[model samples]
Target: MRLWLLLLLLFACPAYASEPAVDTLPPELVRLRDEGRLTVRALWAWKLVPAATATAAMELRAMGLDLIGADRAQLAAWVREAEEGTAAFSPAQREVLSGLLAMMDSGDAAASADMLPADAPAAAALPVPGVVDAVPAAPDTVDTAPPAPDVADAAPPLPDVAEAAPSVPGAASGPAMYRCGAARTGVSDASGPAGPPVELWKLKVGDGPCTPPVVLDGLACFGSVDGHLYAVDVATGALKWKFFAEDWVDQPPAMAGGTVFFGNVVGDRSGDRHFFALDAATGSEKWRFKSLYYGVNSSPAMVDGAICFGAGKHVYSADPQTGDAKWSLETSDTVGTPAVSDGTAFFAHANRLTAVELGADAEKWTFRAGANITTCPAVSDGLVVFGSDDFNIHAVDVQTGVEKWKFGTGLIHHPAAVHDGVVYAVSADNLHALDAATGTEKWKVNMQRAGLKAPVIDGDALILAAGNFLVSLDRASGQERWRFEAGGEITSPALAGGVAYFWSEDGHLYAVR
Candidate 1:
């Protein structure tokens, strides 16, 4: 993205609240697309061009260069070239930019505080040019650090600087712990946000993507690519504490008895990766199990006092409090986040859904799919359901790991939601409701470009996001109820105390109510 467009987007509202349908693209945009100049980034910026120019003008004005109407018109031309896009700007707009460039050539520039903030804590549409470039590609080695300083959970608005850097309810009164973490029950009873949510607060932790947060013990904790697990006050969004992982902490943490357990990704480094248990209140290290070969992105499932998660080529069951290994089962690849039920850990990887008796580390059975499984299995009603790249939804018997039923559909990515014996599978173009006992379709609604994260069941509504709209659908009828427009494409949502918590690539963890 061009530097100007980035600044403009940061200042202006989204171009469109919902994904633009094919019929809606303006003529100029369609023409650019035909000319091969309208890239995804260019299209997005063009959509916002109507509102983007004002911000750039304000910043330029502060630098003592007055921008006229012609200059502003030429701005679009400058934007495309800034990113090396082929789109042409109006001649009227181009002339203005030429003059502005000439003036800038004389070093007549002023540092615009609004363009980048002082903290350098939040990220932009993309990583800032030098921000990630500044960090060493790989750290030397792993270091175990205890309780770190508290970050203000409720900090100021997303800092100007571009750089910084879901879970099972059945298992109770918390948001989804990881992406489809509540797969076993596939339901949450918490009533998320009563109305169109207003941004209550945001915490600028790092200049990278954050994992879906696990809200536990009055604190919202999640890992970040910055190699830290951050715990913030749920009510105030104040950073209570943070623990450094010395590598990317890419998954959500599992919290039990005031201790938060989570995993990280071992990048291009020789040092072994570590899965850690940290003090929830103070961010102190309790214990950590070091990985032998792979880094862990699978969020651990806590059941029967065992933390079961897949890392490297194995799924291990360890004591959550002590990080002592009880059992480890070798797997074919890095496994999906495990769902727990009846003392069994259910997860997917390499086109197979496997069940293992926890504690004993005994294999129960494995159900192989026709294609690679794209998500964790949603277990319910004695059946475990999941989607695959085979363009099918498969439900297997929990006891036998045998295919109970399969429903064909477009490629599925997000984990399905099962509530009241019904599997709610949100696929690329359809939100399907199927009978959990059989593969019978109960109801189906067109989602049309749904998000990749699993939907959250808030009371009787399925909260889903497509494009920039966070939509609520009646769970039973599959009828749309409401749509909340966010600043960016919404990801996963977690609810607690009527507040819906979700994050987007826009660089902030949003708590809305």
Candidate 2:
């Protein structure tokens, strides 16, 4: 009885051991494929091998994903099954699987399905997401269907070829040049004598003050450290749209054609900079240029089918159509926007004003100043007027490259604006009007304790923003005409349409008529 019992036990133990240890799959994986919790069709294209295939690796690389250990033969066999119209996958899924397989064979691992020929059937398929192996179904549970034809067996269509280039419109004749950073192309049409100020309308923008606004096709555009460039309706002061940047925008925007351009500082060293062009009507991004130097502080200028701006120590001229750089002029230090006149470009670098011939790629001349130039040069009436930190206003003959004259103001800031024949500028405590022809001081007004910014001229009034005051003065004399006070610092220059537009440092943009 004991021997029989031992034999029975030994046999039972052997039977138990041979029974394939009750194979069990993980709940997560089972849920992934079986219940549509995840789909097996998506995993068909993943290459199983790391080496043995360059195309597979590149595909993974372009998607910013990593592939570790994988089996090449297993991956290929799986792809072949998918391409042959395996019923386990939908037609759309099989197409994606085939593309992934072809990418692997081509050694273009990063190649995207979008790069496939438009006529390729796989191009119409939706791709699977994520990375992992599909759980194989039981043999009895596998779907039965007719196998698909291999794509490699079919000849691809010939590539479409083109020879004649498309015609483009010829460039329009260049607009007349005005030197003084003044937007005025010629004398104004208004001929009325000075009288009582006319009120148009007043609309408040925000609390933080902003730079003078640029007007384009009835849209007034300006930027603030508040990180927005606003376009307001020129007639109604109604909000059009606001474009946001990564950081503060201290400079006014430049508007040309139908685009608006501006820049901002970014990154740890503030060395990361970006320039953006937005649609003038919709405020959508048209294009952008980024750099590793601190953001551009100078406003951009457009001329001769190019957009030019200063970035770090280089001056860039980019194609207006595609934002492609045409050429760059490298410099040793920071520079300002180049003023274009008659195919010549003038810009201030450190303490020197340099002239560059636009198409010739040569320096025409450079005039030395005692201090750095922080303001844009105004060109008009055959003379160039600008301010320098050296505490003097220098007037140079544009044609002869000679210093017409220099007047010391004792306080250095930016240069003056020239209109008619007078140069208007401001020092720390005084505003001076000088004769542009000879640089002779015409009249001086003591501000006592006021802090003034660059001035703008509208008709017969000089618009100036100082501290909390936006003051208008008679152009012929230095007498204050009208003043409006708001409770904030005035850091930007004033702009005038029919009404005066200015911003307060307290974050408010104001329009006074």
Candidate 3:
């Protein structure tokens, strides 16, 4: 035969002798290879899926997914044997081989590969990697002092911190969690001094403060990175009590019916599913409601004897006394603190604001935003105001889902503070006071940095954390009234009973008057 014809004749019908006609790999490996959501590149980037089979084997062993390992040559030989039908994998022993094949083929690696189960294994808590200590340098004008002893351990009776100011009419006597609830309106009947504020006392907590001073009765309750929820005396900064959790307590504590409700992040899952309830008078644990989802970062709202909070993808309503889930609303995305007004629960999440009926537990209306909205919505007078990452402050009519107006602003990570007819938005670069009815800018002040919390409306002054300072601005014209550098980036400040509280990144909580 001719050379070309001889070669063709030899190659034809010679390769199918031992090959399995259909995919005979284990079901799990097959499933993973075909159904994984992440791209191979993404898996490699997360270090969950390695680019090389040998590396993948090592990683799988380290993560405890695989025990019997193989070297690169052995791995190659196994693949070749399986391909040539010299060996076959059984279900019981397929995980390692299947994992390698699935990763090689860019298959679905299972969600567990991305996130560990909450109850899987408890890990040690170091300083919480990737989280920076928030202590900023103290301002040149202010007295830079060392942090006091841990407030939970050594807080002393502080002197009077309240300064004389006009009282806000009809201020509700409640803890200022999220500074007046998840709408983050930060509005309070408590008023601060007309002039510059003086630091009454500074109490050192652990690092990574979220929001603070949910003052109820005479105690100021707050959470810290030390994995403890602390209650300090409002007048004297004295340590009242502290409750420990599994991880960081970043959300402010909500209070109602003599109980305090708060959530904490367990491990890297944001927060575990448990929403904790404690006795407000004592630091004793009352009850904890386990939800269907984890990572409950939003502050809880007490509405009609029930506590409502956002966790993962659902907004949950539970009994405040028994810690039983009453109802939950499946939302489009992960939700924030819910604002309850006139039987309607307003939630800001993803790129829309959803209003669900508290009584019926049904979605009433949804106002779509141009971008994702992480901040909660402030609802009042049939109007809901919130800020979006889209760099706009939106005012939507609650009854109809119709957008009233959207005022252009910089990047806004926090909610808008709606008071009377004016809306205060702390954007990425400026503090803007807008007309709520028309979304028109009344005045804008250069705040120099975006506020992480809503501007706390303390009578005439707006207390906000801008840049590294806890700043008080004129609520009407957005004029700077006073500012105190907290020597760390501040989260949100809370105002109650004429005493303003600041939670800074430097692991210090300051009470200012």
Over the stretch 1-513, how does candidate 2's per-residue lDDT look in tens digits? 999987888788887546553212233333453554332222222221122122222122111111212233434565675466332232333354455444334433235436343322231232333434443221110122112212322312211112212121122222211221322222223222133444344345531335566654556678754456776665655555666565546567777667778776431111236888877666778888885455565667777777777666667778766788877776656656567677676777777777776655667888888756655677788887777756688888887668999988865454466788998888776889999888888999887645576766767877676767777778899998877676575644434345555555544445556
Model 2 bad stretches (over 4 Å):
1-209, 266-271, 491-497
**How many clashes show up per model?**
23, 24, 12
- Better model by TM-score: candidate 1 vs candidate 2: 1
Better of 2 and 3 by TM-score: 3
> Can you tell me which runs of candidate 1 are displaced by over 4 Å?
1-176, 179-183, 268-271, 450-452
- Better model by lDDT: candidate 2 vs candidate 3: 3
Superior candidate under lDDT, 1 versus 2: 1
How would you encode candidate 1's per-residue C-alpha lDDT over 1-513 as one tens digit per residue?
A: 699987777568576344553433334434443454443223222222222222233222211122322232344455556346342232323443543433222211122223222332222232322332122223212233222223534353321112212111213333235643544454655667766667777655543456667675567777765566776677766556666676667667877776788877643223358888866656667888888654674788876657788877688888876888888888776576788888788878667778987756467898887766767777777888888767788988889988888999775766788878888887766788898888899999876764535777877888866656677888889888777666665556777778777665555667777
RMSD of each: 15.7, 23.0, 15.4
The ten-residue window of minimal lDDT in model 3 covers 134-143
Give the local distance difference test score of model 3: 0.61
Model 1 weakest 10-residue run by lDDT: 159-168
